[model samples]
Target: MPARARLADENVDFMSLMSEANRRRVLGKSTPVVYPAGTLLFREGDPARVILIESGLVRVFRTVPDGRQATVAFLRTREILGASLIVSDPPWVCAQIVIDSTITDLDVKTLRNVASTHIQVMTAVATQLAALVRNAHRLVALRSLGNITQRLAYDLLERACQSQLEMGRLDAMVTQEGLAASIGSSREVVSRAMKGLRAAGIIKTTPGVVRVVDPVRLSDTVRAFLRPT
Candidate 1:
């Protein structure tokens, strides 16, 4: 299969590893919160708390020694943040809402307690953590080595594939500014990259939206960068 097709077909619902009853048991203890864009869900050094994204997007970032915030991840619906906190300390990271969001703040104490007695919950947590690690590594590679165009292509294609899974659409509801942040570049650089992708017939962009016109070609752009050169 093409790399882009595989990414879209990949099952990202890590929580589905849990039994239905166990899934309900863990989530039933959570409190849903609706946050508008730009809201900080949590900040660096805040006490650990698990949040389940029911819908919308979140940008997880941390400040570096240079006082610049480095984006760690862009989390979407059906993903869990702070799941690692069940076994470790609160990380030096902050989660901010990038879009209007509905999230469930899981009762951490309950989650920990449930995990102690439930094998399914433990399995689910393991799956989620593994996914997080894989995403973190992929992000690092793209940012460290990819040029603006390749980075933007990967970011847009990633979100587009995610949207396809979640909403049955191949559109990423992101602005150029968001793309820049995701790829650790300036908006002007991202704009140029967007134009490149557009010219290649890989994507179509409008205000606050980028629809994938040729995901295979977009994935090729990203995949080419990842290949040993």
Candidate 2:
């Protein structure tokens, strides 16, 4: 509708392709749902439905046959999940609430009907999918290029980017299990990587927290690993 037109008329965040009109339209057909942290929004292979993240953080992950869950990505407010519905059935991924969040289960059929007619809405959805694919590719590329220490450095730098440095120390809020899931490695491997960083005088660790001594030095170290070997 008019919201789609506004997006077409001006350049907006490329990742946010959906218009407010589309969001409202989808919400009108959705049932509001609230979940506390640790709640599972849906599981892998669950029936596909449109998910509108109204507020808060969601971790999308995959559970291996061995019951280990690997973090794929995180979604926050105003992001649309399961846009893969535009095609046949979607590629299902389980979502767990990382924080108390408000969301909605949008009627997939309504969204499809509206998006079928609105090019902008579809474009936004396509853009979101592209972003996810790009992130996955980046992960693959990083893995191809570095050792666990390098990868852990990159992850620590990423965590630092999202957090604040207090008195020359930055905290990485992740359990070894969670960190292992994020890095696609085992807890023991990640622990060794942490020890490497500690030995290098780059970081100090406590339970569920990593204190970065010098973010600049850490960034420099990560870059060294990222360079051609």
Candidate 3:
């Protein structure tokens, strides 16, 4: 099937799983907004409001005490964000715009009220939180592995698979600096790693676009790194 058709099908499947009451509650409560490529949506400790990705993407990150930043998560279409603040009394991290993206901002008060009245909405929110925790643990595990390049290759390949399955292609609008931050490496290191992947025929990059060329091999490499010793 076509990429657009696949995207639509996936979206429909997602919506079909949502309860009708939850769907009605979400409607008209979210306001669509757009951000520039480099805009900072929210900072750590800033106020929290639920956001749904209408289109494009956003990166959630946190700043280290030493002043470096680390990317914690990537939010795409149909993904809900700001749950940390919604569920917790304290803020956990910051969110930033990785690319020019559109999002629907939902009022936290409204969401809280809906969650209080709708058991399904509350359950769904809890499920999403559990998934976030798992991803966080995976990142911690990845950080303990071989080298920066290896970690980056793992992250890139995993992300590529998700993007490919969701959008029917492996196209990422990421810079070397962004990849470095995500993988706990320097830009120079990420550059060298990109070169290595290109030489190995695993990926290709030009300017702002990174494309997966050999997804099967890339997946094998990631799996090998993740294997139990």
- For candidate 3, write residues 1-229 as lDDT tens digits: 6433333322222223358868768544566888865466777767766777776655666777885666566555676677655667634676665446788887777778877887777766665665555555555576666476668766775565345434656766678888888777799988988898899988889897688776546645543444334
Candidate 1: tens digits of C-alpha lDDT, residues 109-184:
8888889899878767776776566667766788668888878877786677546544766799999989888878
Off by over 4 Å in 2: 1-20, 144-150, 153-229
Q: Give the winner by TM-score.
A: 1
Best by lDDT: 1
* TM-score of candidate 1 against the unseen true structure: 0.65
List of clashing residue pairs for candidate 1: none
Instruction: Give residue 31's error in model 2 in angstroms.
Output: 4.4
Q: For candidate 3, report its TM-score.
A: 0.62
| Overall lDDT per candidate, in order of appearance | 0.73, 0.67, 0.64
Each prediction's TM-score versus the true structure: 0.65, 0.59, 0.62
Clashes of each: 0, 0, 0
Q: Residue 118 CA error for candidate 2 (Å)?
A: 1.3
